[model samples]
Each structure stands twice: as C-alpha cells, then as structure tokens.
Target: MGSDYSKDNCVHKPPMDERNLQGLKDYLINYNLPDGHEGYINILLYGMVAAGKTSIINTFFSALDPDGRTVTCVPTGMDPNSLTLELKTYKLAKLKFWDTAGWNAMLKSHVKPKELLRMILEGRIPIGTNLQNFKPTFPEEYPVIPGNAIHGVAFIFDMTTMDNISGNIMLRFQELQTIAAQICGHRVVIGTKFEKLGINEKNHAWIYEYKPLQQKFEQLSASTGLNKQCMFVVSNQWNGEHITMIKRILALYALENMIRNIDRSLKMTA
Candidate 1:
C-alpha cells in the first residue's frame, strides 16, 4: 500500500547546485585520517532485507565516476536470504564503506542485537561469515586488536514498505541507537524507493516537502532518538532520461550524512 497523498499536492525544486556537489566530492577525496590511523574512514551500512543498501553504494560510485561508468563493485540482489552474507568493504579513496548481511528479524534467535553490535563495533566478524545460525566471535580470537571501528552507520529502509516497520524492526533499530551512543558514532536513516510512494521523479523537494511522510519519520526519530536531520528519502532505482541527475542528488544526500556522522565521531573522540 502507498501513502494517501496525490501528485498534484507534491512540491518540486531545482536540481542540486554544481558548486555544492563539487565541494562534497572534494571533501570525500581529501578527508583527513585521524592520528596513527592509516586506513580509510570506515562507514558501516546496515538494514533489513531488500533495503537497497548495495544499490545505494553503486549509485554513489556511479556519481563519483567522471567517465559516467556504472560501478557495481559489490554484489547486490533481491534474495530473501541475505545477499550480502559477509562483511564486505568497498574503498573509495579515504572512505571505506562496509556492507553487512541484512538483519533479519526472523533470525533474532541467532543474530542477537548485542552480538551484532560487537561484530560491527569491533570489526571482529570475519568476511564471508553468514549471519544465519551465526555464533558471535570473541575479541580475543583476533591476532591483533581490531581497530577498524565504524565512524558512521547508515540504516537504509525501503520507503515503499514503511507500513511494514514492525515492532521487531523498531526494537532492533533502538538497539543500534544504544550502540551508537556508546561508541560515539552518528546514525542516519535513508529511505529508498520514493517512486513506490507515487512521488514525482522530478520533484527534488520531496525530501521534506510532504508533511505526512516527514511526520511519520519525525515520530520515528523521536521514538528512536535519531537526529531529525539525519533522515533522508531518495529513489535508488530511478531510471529514465534524468537518471544521472537523480542518482547524483541521492549520492549527494548520502555523502552529506556520512560526512556529518564522521565529523560528529571526530568531535567525540577529541
């Protein structure tokens, strides 16, 4: 089911500024590594199944490619079983995007929140490790103390299935919030598939233009203690004449949130 809003009432805006886009590109390219840290800034992406996390990463890379090449470095699919069965990391210059298996509420028995937090926070989970029936690995198992702690976490949600935001989902999200609070990293929510809600593709103002949609997320943020500004809605599957601009806009918002989280993390560590 979709929202009750109609297309006539929707708002629209001009395309994103070229200057701002360039600034974000430069920021990601020239991000400073913290003292004694040689690796890229680790940004963890997590969400339920079919939330389009992988597509978001691909879209980001496509936007950054000057040759306009479509980059699908990470594998992505719609399998109900987690497509990303491992802790995969994609590096773009100074930024490292880590994509984990989709969190299944049905598998809560095997994937407890605390254990998942440990795997993410300490980077203890081994690559290609399936989360189904998964056992938590202790920190001592590592030869050296894993220091690739995430500087930011992005929770991608399927906006088309907002009605399916069950109690189980909210509970898990709350657990993530608790972990982020403890680790001093920032959390942002990205709502994908705006087209499913009948949102016009050319309407650039859809991010915060629709009051009802904004209110729904605002209430969720209030309950989950997520920063209201961290929520963004975009169409990851938009394909048409203006596909490039749409993807670029989506990438801009995604990177903007990532940068905000990174800055927040640095301040907390300082």
Candidate 2:
C-alpha cells in the first residue's frame, strides 16, 4: 500500500533536437497523486451466473485505459474432476477488480456438505483439516473469506430474470444478503443487462429501463431491511449517451466508496 502520487523530480534534462524540444515543451503538464496516498482500490465483484459481472469489470477497465488495454474472461465448466483453476483480474487507475465465480450449484457439490457438517459437529473440519479443499468446488470459485481488504462488493443481478418470476423472488435476495453479510457487510445491489428491457424514461438509464423489477427489488429490500445497502443499476453496454450515464452512476456508487475509504485511512493516520 504505497502512494503512486509524487512530484516528478527527474534531473536528466535530455538534450533533444529542435523538433523534439518543441514537442516536449507542449507536452509538459502537471499531474500527481495527493500526498500520503497509496493509490489502489480493491473491489470485489459478486453475482449470479451470466449476470454481467465480468462485463462491468471490463467496461470499467476499458474506460480507464485510454490505450484500450484488454481484459480477458475465461470460462470454466462445472466438471467435478477438473484440475486447473483460473482467476481473472482487470486492473485500472488505482483500482483492481477481483471477479469471483458467480453462484451456480453444479460444482458446489464437490464439497460434500453433509460430510463437512459431520466434521463440524465432530470438530474435525477445524482440526488440521484443509479448509480450502472443503470450499464449494465450483468453476472459478474460491472461498468467501480469501481477502480481508475488500472495500466493497457490487452484488450484480439480472433484473429481467428477477422480474420474470413473481413468486419466490425474495428467496434470491435473502440468499444474496446472507452471503454478503457473511463475507462483509459492504454490499451494493446492481441490476445489469438492461439493454433487453425497453427504455422510455429519463436519459435511458437502466434505473428507468427496469421500473417493474426495480420496484420489486425495492420492496424486497424494504421488507428485508436491506434497502440502505442498495446502490445503482447499470447497463454498461448501452449506446454512447446511456453508457456515459451508467459510468457516472457506477463511479458515484462503486468508485466513490473506495475513495471515501482512502480518505478515512488518511484521517485515521493523521
């Protein structure tokens, strides 16, 4: 945790040709990170399968990379005897994203929960038994408590699917909240894949695009006492204007929270 913010004190004044000297003079501009800053934000992304979690990460990375830095999302099947496990990360200015596996039950069976429960009652799971191996063995999935420095978690959900099922919708919400609370209480619910929904509201934002689902989620959140933790709804694949709006919303919700954490760190040190 070191601040990349610093004033350049480069002493080697290169003797450039006339053309290069003019170019250098024009390119000189002041840019720096604030004093006593360790410039990095750790964001943990959680969501269900195909909920556009990876796409949100990709969008943020692409937005930060003016040079079009590429990020990859490698798919893994839910095979029981798979050997290789791959983790993906998308890095940007002062931000590093850890996109964990979405919740799909196919690979989770590898854990043998009944045996683990027996071990817990017998006090064996904690007694010199490897807990990592006992984790819900899903493709691209890791145990929830891997990192302690997770500042915030963007809990992405597909609004369209959530809306399709009228009854038992709150079940997923409860599950999501439980998982988030188990990991850390910093959870923000985001609705992704808004392009599939029609848009006729203000500025074509996904917030307006999925009004029915949004209201359902709000009602569920209120009943569950989790409305306060809810943040923004985003559709990063929207057209130019909508894309800008979504980016701004995500930044305000996700990125700004990280910034506030950094500020808190500075204040505590002071």
Candidate 3:
C-alpha cells in the first residue's frame, strides 16, 4: 500500500534538487494513507504508553501466534513502556502491520530516535532480518529497510480516558499530524479501549458511557478532516463482534484507497 519499491524506480530515476529532495523526503518520512497495494496494507501502530497498543495486536493476530511470545522481550513485560527496541511485523489477510513502540520509548535508550527515523526515511537498513533475535539500538546499527515502505500509521488512543478534555491531547494530536504530514502525508487515528465504552450483552461490562467521547471524536474529526478515517469503540476482547466490524472497515479502507493506487500504477496507459 505504498510507492513501488522496484530497484528500477529507485535507480535511474531523475535526481531532485534540494527543495524537491526535501519534499520527497517529507513524503517518505510521515505517516501515509494506504494508497497502492492490493494484497498488502503496511501499517504501523502508534499510541501513548499503556494505551493498549500491543493488546490490540494480540487480539487481532493472536490466532497466528497464540502465546505472543515474540514481543515478550521488547522492553516491558507484556508491554514496551518506552522503546520499540525490537521490530515485529505481522501479516493478516492482505495487510501487514508493523507494531512500533510509541516514539516515547526512545527516551530511555542511548539511541536517538530521530537518527533511526532518518535511516528509515533513507531506506538503509536491510530488509527481512530474523525478527526473533534482531535488536534495534542505534540508527546505523538497526536492521531496517532502505527507503520508506510504510503506507499507513495507526494512532491508537485510550477511549476510556477523559484526556480528551485536556488541551494537551489536541496539541499532541496536531504535532503528530504535522510530523506525519511531513513524513508520509497522512495518518489515521484509532480510538482503543472501547471495551470500557458502552457495553453489550455479548461483552457487556463497560464502566463508562462513550457518548461524550464520541462527541469529542466528532470534533476531532471535523478539525482534522479525518471523520471517515477514524475508528471508534474498538474492543479487542469482544466476542469477535466489534473486532470483526473494525477489521472489515480497515480492510475496506485499505482496499478502496491504497489498492486503488497500485492498480493505477499497474494499469496500461492508453
């Protein structure tokens, strides 16, 4: 769900001047909307710590690897509180999700996140290393792909928290959007912890009503123009009901937008 990475497209392509190069660099670095693949939607999960980012991953792809043993060593036990010291990729249906520990994780490590991000933008890291043992510490040292391949970024938030009332959430969201715009030109916000939202007979034990939260989200969407892109009330533990709904929505999102680009690129121009 991104630009074609064919060696020919990278090589032999005309070089850009500094401005154009910077523009391309911005496009390569930010969060992207899925736009050009049929069989795959490359997504990165990002959110504040303790927001249940990994939990969603566990819930969706648990069938593939039951114990979720792979991410156990990342940093925190059952969670990576700070850094994504390790990179793990999972494939489901036609989409691939690259679960990135929130950018905050870079704080504890000696490594600079910006440098690591820059390397990803430039596409210097080797692709397809064994994720089971690969440890990412420094920018030059981490095993990552050369050039940016990420097509989408999923920003997960805890819907149960009233943090939306604080101005900080808006500020942070704007900053993240700006960064994503600079890097990949687009980003998607995902509201998680919906299990705590209005519950149901199948999975009905929620603590709070999410009507207020939905109102806040509506405001957020209007401000960001991400109304259609937003995913609300996601509960990973549901009886495959809400989860299935979200999956279908995400699949349609990727298929309609990202896959369309791939088809266009592959089409024979008359």
Q: In terms of TM-score, how similar is model 2 to the real structure?
A: 0.55
Write down the lDDT that model 2 would get: 0.46
Off by over 4 Å in 2: 1-39, 65-85, 112-148, 164-176, 182-185, 200-202, 205-210, 220-224, 239-253, 258-270
**Model 1, runs deviating above 4 Å:** 1-15, 34-36, 78-82, 105-111, 137-139, 142-147, 240-242, 267-270
The 0-to-1 C-alpha lDDT of every candidate, in the order given, reads 0.67, 0.46, 0.45
Q: Which residue pairs overlap in candidate 1's backbone?
A: none
List runs of model 3 lying over 4 Å from the truth.
Answer: 1-40, 62-84, 108-148, 162-173, 201-210, 222-225, 239-270
lDDT of 3 by residue, 63-87 (tens): 2222222222223324325334355
Q: Please state the error at residue 230 of candidate 3 in Å.
A: 3.4
Q: What C-alpha lDDT, on a 0 to 100 scale, does residue 249 get in candidate 3?
A: 32
Model 3 TM-score, all chains together: 0.54
Using TM-score, rank the candidates from best to worst.
1, 2, 3
Clashes of 2: 2
Which one is best on TM-score?
1
Candidate 1 displacement at residue 145 in angstroms: 4.5
